[model samples]
Target: MPQKMVEKIEEIAEGSDDGLCDVIFHLKSQDLTLTHVVNAGGVAFRNRSLVTSATELLPPSLEVLRERQPRTIRRKTDRDAEEPSFASTIARAPISASPLEETIARNYDRLATAIASAALRPSVERVKDRTKDRFRQYRPAVLWSSESLRVALRRDDLLDLRQRTDFLASLNDVYPNQQVGVPRYFSPARSSAKVQGELSRVAWGVERVGAPAAWGAFGHRGAGVRVAVLDTGVDASHPDLKGKIKGWAEFDGSGAQLPRSRPHDTDRHGTHVCGTIAGGGHSGQFVGVAPEAEIYAGLVLNGRKGGTVAQILAGLDWAIEQRVHVINLSLGGRTLERVVRSPFHRSLFHAASIGISVVAAAGNDGSQTSGTPGNDFFALAVGAVDVKDRCAGFSGGGTHLITESEHIGPKLLPLAYSKPDLCAPGVDIRSTVPKEAWGFLSGTSMATPHVAGAVALLRSACQGFSDLPGFRQSSVIQDIILATTFDLGERGLDHRFGFGRVDALRAIDAASGWVTDTSEYRDRRNRSPVAPPSARGRLGRLPGIGPADPGA
Candidate 1:
């Protein structure tokens, strides 16, 4: 590359970092020698995955169990199981009120110094002596995968590393970590018309989507299905969430897992999202779309700064490890132009490839504003609608042009997917909040959980759907939902409303019919090739799919 071009690329990349100089490097090889060169330059690296085999090289203080663990490690049911000291230390540490960026920086500094003193020592210092000595203190934040590494490096050192032929040959790409946050928007105050009795017990959004109807007809309220809520965290003590939280963990801004994490919300956003997904109707309020579903809550965001791309990815990796059936990301972040290949996109693709239904919030910026992960082709980006089934004013919609990553996922298809796969009730949505309270929120964030919960219901109702090949399960479910939706805005798939507002009863009926018969199947990109008619249509009622409930 020309010097001017390298300078331009570096300048563009500089704007994306959170002032921590944190950048992720995807190398062509998992060889430690490539990393050793960087490490010897006084750069301390924290391994999230790659260090497993290097356990013997780790200091005695690490105390890693020598026993080889399976790649698909099951969630430890016994809380007493031994954990890494780093996790336990964090578990015992007090929650700091410091700025997230500053806190993360401090943690990295401490960790780097510790590793230098304990692990690196004389050998690393001797190697550093032979170098040009341009490098100073650098921190190891996280090792995302065997080939991907995240670290805090000085600008000059980063430039130097890029110029090295040895390093450059092994490096696939390097980019600053992006910031992520809840895609929530505030709505204007509306008239407080009080409702009493049964009508007020169940949320209007829940009823509008016909969740109760689907539950009664299919006899499945997402039973035996697992949904991962990657957000602030769920309030486990909430009445509606009792007996619903099956697993819980927290991730730092660097995407490292916090030790001994328990169920607790740093903000009400996560609690509300979780409630809408699987909260039991214990408080006489049927707030959740799938009341019987189990939750695997990962606290990826907290306080004002929210979180970073690394944190969300860590939470996502944790969710995938748990073998959850569905994932709800009620959050998003800007996709920078400088990014040639997005780690988040690849992660979503990996999740979808394994049959997990990933639902995300279409950003709240309105019009042609779409956020990443949601904008990614694999994610089922959900838009927002009001009680009257009108698209929310702040609902984001746009067409994602395939510019950088033309080939994505196992299929190697050009994933030039559009925004808002479907819409769901979001305006004035009432659900459980922290401190045992119920409140109303309006955003695409709120709508996302509705779709996620619906996916859970579909998974439970249509058992063995996982037997479908990679990505087929989620694609089929998305197809059923899109086909059964009540069309709004444009005639077919449009920006405002991708298909239309989700109709749970109709979707479940269609899924039930398809799974029972399995005679007709379609494979296409962007939209379903043909919409499956309603129960009363020409196809009539299949053996399992019955007539739509008159009460719905």
Candidate 2:
């Protein structure tokens, strides 16, 4: 590569958004390495010549180098950085002098920024188009109305008509007379038997708190709670999951129609997650976190293995309108600066205000970092822990929470402070398979649904508490789960385990007003101790068995 050509390539790449460019040059030297960044538009590259392959290595190949380029630029003048004086002024005003009023004002300002950004971004439109397309193909039974149909339907006999064969036939071109089963799933006899066995054993009872044991003990079995699994579309017809799936929306630009059952396991990841959250245990094989919770499957990620932030937001918005009680997000990526002004986060906040609990998996990057939306405080960010209750090697950590200002610009960047609110079993967990089979997988993606299911259990058990008049509503359901976790990572709440490992039985007990002592809890990651013989046996029996036993 010539010096002049190198400088020219560098200039073009630097000037492009995200320091990327698409151009090819025949280098005079074979020792030069070419690096390129490629996107939908095309590819860009940079090359560096070296005396030997080992010295600096040839620049990446033109193809490889082009694929690495940034798709967009981060500018100081980016709209997200500008302060909203009017909204800020209104927010800071001493209106009513009440805490609630102040909170509302602050939220209003945040909402304003989010809305503005949504209006300006073309990504939002693309996401909407994709979502609408998917719905048109599968689950076409779902009607889209420009007006408030839920309200209008409430005043008419539309819901009643939905139960009528002729009306359904008129509305849907396929299987008009087919009856849709109730979304929730449960087995009183089976649950009672499992709960009794756990209660009879001390260690088992203690370890599985807020889990199936707790779920079985209380009759609040996720009766009315609706959970939105935002990932690949679910196998709505899987025998174990058939009636348990209530609704679905595809944001993959294919148009929504009846969910396909054949290629249910295309990704396999989402199906496994769905099983973990609501699998009916029909084969006496696997049971979900909240067996009776209604599930609304949203396919945000496509078969191609990746998706954008916009697609995720569209799924979230639809979930909110459906009044889903809990949202389980198991996918994430690097944080973008514009995310703070994202309508997606604002919608999540709106859902939170209305009692929706959002649970997301921290990235599997194996560092003290978090991805957007998951990084958002309103969403309960979860990390991965092994069966032995040790932090998974790939789980991300948190050092400090990023503020809105830091997330916006200038100094706006992801902070490496304390993160990952809590950890759960993320390594080698087995769950439902798309084609009526079962498989094991790993990642924080597997960890998130654990919390989602736990939330469903809490929702079921806390019906009375939530119904209580003026109970102070001090925290969201995510907070309750975090506060009740068994603190095990460090002196207090640190990055490894934000609050601590999730104990289903304990969380449920806490919801019912039963508190426990946490002084004896230890961080297995830092401690030099051996598990008791009995504990070792129990650990060995855990679902997923990894090669390296950290506890050992």
Candidate 2 runs further than 4 Å off = 1-210, 253-266, 336-343, 400-417, 468-474, 514-552
Model number with the top TM-score: 1
Report how far off residue 66 is in candidate 2 (Å): 58
Residues 305-376, candidate 2, lDDT per residue (tens digit)? 554344565577678668687889887664434223222344454455445778888777667666655666
The residue-by-residue lDDT of candidate 1 on 78-182, one tens digit each, is 221222212221222221223324433543454355335422244334434533353232334443322345555444455554454544444455556656765
Q: How many backbone clashes does candidate 1 have?
A: 1
What's the CA RMSD of model 1 in angstroms? 15.4
C-alpha lDDT values of all predictions? 0.62, 0.48
The residue ranges of model 1 lying beyond 4 angstroms of the native Cα positions read 1-9, 12-20, 27-147, 169-172, 187-198, 335-341, 406-416, 519-552
Q: Point to the candidate with the largest lDDT.
A: 1
lDDT at 77 for candidate 2? 59
